[model samples]
Target: MNPMAAMKAYAAVQGGGMPTGGAAPAAAPGFGEMLQNVMGDMTKQTRAAETQMTGAIQGQSNMIDVVTSVSSAEASLETVIAVRDQVIQAYQEIMRMPI
Candidate 1:
């Protein structure tokens, strides 16, 4: 899996369409939009990994491709988990502040 291609796919998904040969959009995405986009990308990567694994099991896909897909999915899940942990920690700190 090419990193550039994966990034491009992410960008396209976040943009809500295929990337055009132009400058970035002017408006910033809302938190909900960003979360939705990230979830969508994660789902795509997970599905790709599953498909690759099934194909490999059937001798239709290369082991390297399956490994790459699985690794990508694992990395994405780790990133999500790290973000969640930070968010939870931040909330805890906020709750601990003198009110």
Candidate 2:
């Protein structure tokens, strides 16, 4: 079983749809902007992981630090992939609707 399988399942079940109630539009970030921010963070984590691994190789960082950073980056990557897959699935589902 994938480590993120539960998270992915929860995300899929949530549907991530827009709110139907009347709320301040400015209070919430737009979907596109939120996704962009997540992408940026993922990039940063990947870079950080690489740096940690390099430091470990040079004996500047411990194996524990390297392992933790790499694990974090891997989790982020999996999250991004799960989000991408969900978005694609949503798009496909929308396309199948008879309008």
User: Which candidate achieves the best lDDT against the true structure?
Assistant: 1
**Cand. 2 Cα-lDDT:** 0.76
What is the per-residue lDDT of model 1 for residues 1-99, given as tens digits with 9 covering 90 to 100?
236645754665576654478867545566566666667777889999999999999999999999999999988877667767988999999999997
- Model 1 weakest lDDT span, ten residues long: 1-10
- lDDT score, candidate 1, position 93: 98
TM-score of each: 0.72, 0.74
Angstrom error at residue 27, model 2: 3.4
Model 2 clash pairs are none
After superposition, the stretches of candidate 1 with alpha carbons farther than 4 Å from their true spots are 1-25
lDDT of 1 at 19: 41
lDDT of 1 at 25: 57
lDDT of 2 by residue, 4-90 (tens): 544544454465567578963334455776677677777888899899999998999999989988898888788889899999999
